[model samples]
Target chain A: MIRILIFCLSLLCCHHLVARKPEPEHIQIQPVFGTENLKLNTYYLLNNHTDSILIETLRFYISGIEFFSRGECVYKEKNSFHLVDLAKPQSLNISLAGLAGLEYDQLTFNLGIDSTTNVSGAMGGELDPSTGMYWTWQSGYINFKLEGHYHSGATKMQQFVYHLGGYAYPFAGIQQVKLPCKPNQNHILILALDYLLQADFSAIHPNIMSPGAEAVQMAKMVAAQFSLKE
Target chain B: MIHVPLKLAVICFGLAACRSNSSSFEKPAEWPEPVYDFSKNPLSTEKTTLGRALFYDPILSADNTISCASCHSPYNAFTHGDHNVSHGIGDSTGTRNSPPLMNLAWHTSFMWNGAINHLDMQALAPINHPDEMGENTAHVLQKLNASNFYRQLFYNAFGDSTATGENLLKAIAQFMVSLVSANSKYDQVKRNQASFTAQEQNGYALFTQHCNKCHTEPLFSNFRFENNGLPIDSSFNDYGRMQITQDPQDSLKFKVPTLRNIEFSFPYMHDGRFKTISEVLNHYTSGIKESSTLSPLLLNPMVLSSNEKVDLLAFLLTLSDREFLFNPAFAYPKELFLPAPKD
Candidate 1:
């Protein structure tokens, strides 16, 4: 009878231990282009540019998400790569399950595909080869894709397609980004479309489909355009 | 050191067991860790057999007439030998020569221009090219789904009959990664099991001095894009690496081809310009065209006498691995595709 009682106590203790660890909380990452928080295919005016221009397509990969508390990393999502596509509005919002009760003060992630995955063979999920983000001619993933039209004062509108990608030395496109965050809040990351106005459409039209100086420059600019949506 | 042989015996036994089932990766001696991450797509005999079937099947192509084997035949070291350039569906010729496929597990990039980055993604180009297979993934999936044979094969390989793009590409990669070539005479010499002939030894000395920098030992090729001083073709005007990078400095650079199985893999170079190995040597020795983007190693002319050239060619033959070329395991899946005739 005493032995049975001891077994029951131990079972209850194990259950208590498991109960103390809370379930993970779900956190969402919403992508916004300028002030509109608009859907894809919507045209927006370029801010502070000499000519009026509109952006129609914006897509990129966000990966290596980690959460830190008191400067110590507490939680990191396993296989944290995501493709934030504008054409598919659903892909823009990434819902991450954070550890329960662990205070997350800051968030960090990559704005483009990491070099490791680029060298590794075919992958599925968001990083799948079917995503159309992969360059068929070249082996690496396009870090980000920005396509739009620039309207000159004259009648002809110029189309601009910028595909920024490179994984080798001298031109790695992956950029690290960190931002402060509150737990469980729907923090939206804004991609400042105005920064794109700096591109000289006439001089560098169809810029950077592969690795080079132009690709590295555009990737740096795209990484800089991110800010917490107010 | 006395018990080292026993330890080796145990390891060899373990490796033999692993090879019996095709799901494991074997790291050869002195090779760098493979770039292919097998964790994501673990190899299985079922997956590899299915992939081999897919490689030879006309079902992947639009017209069901052209397969990967059409351009990359197993007999010719996985490269078509009849034509200078690849002939695709409808008898349309491609601009570039089809590269021979082997030792793919180590390659960081694919294609002559280093255009395709991954081996898994390499098939997409030939599959979708208008002159090639001319089929899209959606149509190919539909065709694969319709076939009862493929349905069962997919079920056995991936636990279900659904022909998704992920499983399709992963299965192909499984077969490709298995094409390892480390059984050549040169490899045996490196292992101390064999000795080079006097002629080959002299050739090895010359090769070490002139070629080892670009075509590194063991693997044979450094796999970097370099302009080997080939003058731009006036007709084709193939500015190799520049087309991908769009940088003028990168113009005329092409991925260095491996010299393995050179005896069989003829009509060489990106455009299949050299029909014989002697022609290739002559070009390297005297035919180097001056260019700004030429590889610095080739800036100074190669000073090989006629006798040294013969010796170098003799050494090059040591790279041929008959074990890889004639491996029945890599041959067509005849039992799966064709019905056996009753005696």
Candidate 2:
């Protein structure tokens, strides 16, 4: 009967190309004002060549937005965590293709806040540590609070502010960043806090709210700001 | 989002609904272990009568003329006695000196320089202090949800008629944990039904040898933060607990007051400057000031005599109780705020 209907239409087109699934990608760290403004302002101070010193307020926060296939690690939580905040850049355009664990490689979380959300009481957007970034009085949670007033030249031009946060134990804000993607499919990462004064931390100790150990040196000056545009 | 509740009902519709105090009774025996954590909001009795009617409502003060009994006044013991400061709302005052809300369940921290670490958020620092009770916890929860007796006493202690600032700081931590004073007279000499009198037992053996290592006794206050030496009021340059822990070793310290009712919490430290506890035992036996942050038990200097400051003011007037200072179930409920206050 016509060669058994051409072997069942080649086994239903190889089960619709191995159950198509891909969609998890996003990369919008846009904030340029130097190297001739390509446009994206919330006070740009981007960084590069690993000297990382992007100032004028660049924030960070990402958590398990995961999705992979080949290297494992399937799709993640309902809305795990993501607080970019250039004050609010329309939720930084992210899109990770049709996910379902297809050999994934990188993109883990935390550059701050992990004392189980500081005793887990009251939380809204921008991870609401009551957004004074919390330090109403000698307590914790100030993973980072740059604050401005730069300039330190010849005679009297100093007004720097740096309210970095702490988690207390000798003070901690445990930062982390990993990049490299696609074993099966899905990836997107771009956290660029200007470049955090090229990781020198304005020669260390600008300002910190509370926690301990000078917020572990501003979480190693915000994990040296993070790169890899791929 | 619990802020102005209808301009807080044209100034507290007579402290709407407040009258709950039963303290579920059994908190008696030896008493010293509370530091307030009733496991994050427990004690009921309609949340201590809606936190003693939002602590004597002047709708928690903004334009409704002060009310945290206008500066902790459960008649001198909740303490505003002889006003050494603490005036608030148009009467302005305060640079420090109100200190007298009783036993705060025992206190791990709360102002006088501890700065609110949680007595359920210390009535949101005097209800949003522009200068204490300037009212604004989402407009004091829209003036207790435009009171129908505080939405039925917050639907009988939080079944969500909604007043939130965490249930108005857990209904003022259930009327300051029903202001438990533990039936004073040193709790009737620890319930041996009272004894003391040998000039209040030589002022309780010179207050357990110079204030039991920072007032520690049946809840006298081992809450620590010393520096008792005074001297520094250059017009309230008050650096108590080092202006909230910028920490120069908690410079000019503070915290430690609870001598229970130190003869009606008088005008003492934190800028009420010795308004007599015999000028605070003559400045702890002749005004000390070696201060590298003092208090190694006031760093040596305590002479007394003059009948030991009248037997330490007769053992601080036996930490007064008057049934917890005339607690007409913590008065002013005037059948839910009417025209009382004639006294």
Candidate 3:
């Protein structure tokens, strides 16, 4: 009987060992805005521009993350959509834990919520309508929101609020961004808005609450700002 | 060692009981599969009840004066009769008519213009519209968090008292999708439980000939956007689907409104231009304005006589499901909290 009991215990131990799943590797993507240590609502000089601007809010969406190497997909984050808000430091950090032991040369993601989820009604989690990224009157998610004060030539209102978003055809604000990355180590994606400082605010429309040529232009402009940190 | 099998059996039984507690959402065998996936947002009695309460509560509004029920009244088949265009908080006039809410699970898109594609996200439009609720989700959450009644309700539905915006929208959607209207006279006839009258039968034939292409059976909407050639209201200047798609080809196109419960959900059409069913039929027959983007079905004149119109109206009446409109489970939810508002 003792021999039988010992055999059963060994079998149970082996079964436990076989049942264990492999642990996935974790990596973080941090959104560091222009010139690092840039505080919100603080007046700063724009690069080679006469206007001193104060950025109050900068929020945008990043989705459909795909890691690739040698023209083959190494890892693809399932249902990967994230809203990165500059005001909230925690919102800037994204976890790539699902891609454990994956080696990739490049990664690609969209700068706006895809058309499918935008029309798919009230989604839960980050895609929730209550997140303020969603437009109530017009049915679409605002891809990028940039609100700040720009030096106005003569207008009484010096504030500029550009809520750029639209996923429909012709003027679709969905921008695809692909960047090269190191193979083995974890990656941190950086978005530098310094280009906006050089960009003439006088020429750009300030208020873009709906889908139009202006919203599309702003979406493209912000999408071009992403780069991998060294 | 002997008790191990017994423990496993108990766990299995418990899981089975939990699954059984969530009564399966039934889809009528005759109907096509629903567009809304129930697997992601499983239905439970508690969650539905919570959703029903939220639907009736004006607390969702900025001033706590307008609930979803304000525009979508159960008595009127979930649509108001008094307004051509929906009236919102402080009597603010909206641009479009309030569409009736029923059989939404089958719908792939929402709104006359098809601005919203998903039923779950539909509430955000009204909730945040300055003319409607005029409240953001974050503000609504703050109000819900302060209420002891909502705290308990949220805890009962979601297993936590903290009312997140996601949970709030999900609960509302759960209630809206639970509103299934598959027990109309037409449905009864289809199920072999009852037969249509001669007038209704004749009307059904006429409908099949003239309207069934767009107003498909069962759900009564093909759920496609079409320009039915209603002359543009110069004041509102609403371009309909073209506003969203930006393609001039989609000009004046609106999502085909469902014809179910047409008896009560009157003040019909996207802009509520027709008050009576006869007027609507007359418009189709005589008032179809010629347009570049007009639906191909309306390209030729509809030659329906006065008698055929009556027969068609008779058939349309059979689509009204009183059981669905007056189901106590979907009513004001007085048992849950406050009494139903007296209009």
Candidate 4:
């Protein structure tokens, strides 16, 4: 009788050990201008290395991360909203505590906040309005912002600013990104600005402060520039 | 076993305390559920008190010369009385007239153009506009953090001494939502505690026939965007809703202004174009400018005789809730602004 009780206690201990939570997995986002690391306020070559451009600010939101295996969602991050700023290094690394031991072949995330969260009232943490990502003139978040100057000629600089976001119908700017990934690996997602800069800078309007067809088009172009670093 | 009932009693007492705290924001008997999700920012007496103080404080402005109440004075039905367009810091004038503040919890969108989609984000427009408060929200938070009085107020309201933009906006919203103007004569009549005069009764009939579709009963607004045909002011040239939606069909379209407290909330129209209630009536009867996006209901001109206009005006007066305009709670919180208690 005593041997049977001991056997039951050992089984319970094994179950407890098996159910222990695993350590969190990390995903690092690296922003680059072609092969070089992107730096704010620093001049970089663009448009086939013919024009000099300086990026003063570059910030965008990444949210609603989900991991899928064989077309089934294996893990999803709760309240997954992150604001990645070129000026802030620590913010680029996202820790997914839920992704531990998950054998997922696909990673998915929204390039901007979902429409539901945009309509919802004041939120805290990284989604806070004080983060300067929210548009005060209108009730929506600025999903992606890039402001800088382009050198038209020596000593002649033209300022360019882009504030891209809209959650309303007929002009939703949020982009969903799906990428293939290896199982049990820390991922590095690279945002290649060179691809984004390939657009005719002088031809397209340099300023896009409000949401419209141009903002949506630009947001789509920006979303296409993200890729898994090889 | 004895502690179980004791714990249940304690929980019941706690719930009762919470109920008493939110008594300031009571919904009217027949009103629809408020569009604001109260679960996100629950009403509390302390938060409302803090919000009232912030609303009256000029520290929200960059020059410390203007406040929300500067233009939205309580006596004027929370509107800028006699001002065609509201002037802000540095005497800079804004293009649109300041909208009155009442029954905000029922509103799903704000501004004359419906530019703001939520009540919580409405204050940002005036606060950040250069011609208004001319203040950055982050800078405003920093200033609040610097003040000992605000720190205590923040702590009392949110249990955190540090002031954040989220808390600041939420606190202000608490005060605005509490400004319910449900004690008007019309409301009293609706509740069967009072009766309308014969002229008011006739006017109410006419109202139901002509204006009730847009300016609905109870709340006095359908809260939908419509183009009431006022000719474009060449000076301002504001294409109201089209500016936000970027669609030509929305040109000249504006959110239908609530007729509640219309007697005091003039000069009327988005730009305060009409000075008196009669002028507004005249525009409805004769001054509708034709456009492709004109409201289908207004395609046919309204014909109200002069006597009918007077009756309409008299009925409109019944919407004036003096209790709301003179509520001491909504007035300037002089007690809070007094020198902070010595540390």
Identify the candidate with maximal DockQ.
Answer: 4
What value does the interface RMSD of model 3 take? 1.9
* Residue range B129-196, candidate 4, lDDT tens digits: 89999999888898889876677667767878799989998899999999899999999999999999
- Give the residue spans of candidate 3 off by over 4 A: A1-37, A47-49, A64-79, A95-107, A119-121, A153-158, A168-171, A183-189, A200-202, A212-214, B1-20, B338-343
At residue A94, what lDDT does model 1 achieve?
69
The TM-score each candidate achieves on chain A is 0.80, 0.31, 0.81, 0.87
The number of the candidate with the highest TM-score is 4
Please report the TM-score between candidate 3 and the true structure.
Answer: 0.85
Q: Tell me the DockQ of each model, to 2 decimals.
A: 0.40, 0.03, 0.47, 0.73
- The sequence of per-residue lDDT tens digits that candidate 1 reaches over residues B44-113 is 9878877887888888888899888899877778887868888998998887889888888888788898
Query: In model 4, how large is the Cα lDDT of residue B86?
Result: 90
TM-score preference between candidates 1 and 3, better one: 3
Clashes of each: 4, 49, 3, 0
Question: How displaced is residue A73 in candidate 4, in Å?
Answer: 0.7
lDDT of 4 at A200: 78
Better of 1 and 2 by DockQ: 1
- Please give the range of 10 consecutive residues that has the lowest summed lDDT in model 3 chain B: B1-10
**Interface RMSD score of each model:** 2.1, 10.4, 1.9, 0.8
What's model 2's lDDT at A90? Answer: 66
* Per-residue accuracy of model 3 over B1-343 as CA lDDT, tens digit each: 0113333343334433443246567898879998987876788766786788789989888998999999999988898787889988989988788999998899877888888767767887888889998888889888888876776667767778788877787788889998898999999999899999999999999999999999998788899999998999998999999887778999999999888899999899888888999999999999999999999999998999999999999999999999999999889875555432458
Each prediction's RMSD to truth: 8.6, 20.6, 8.3, 6.9
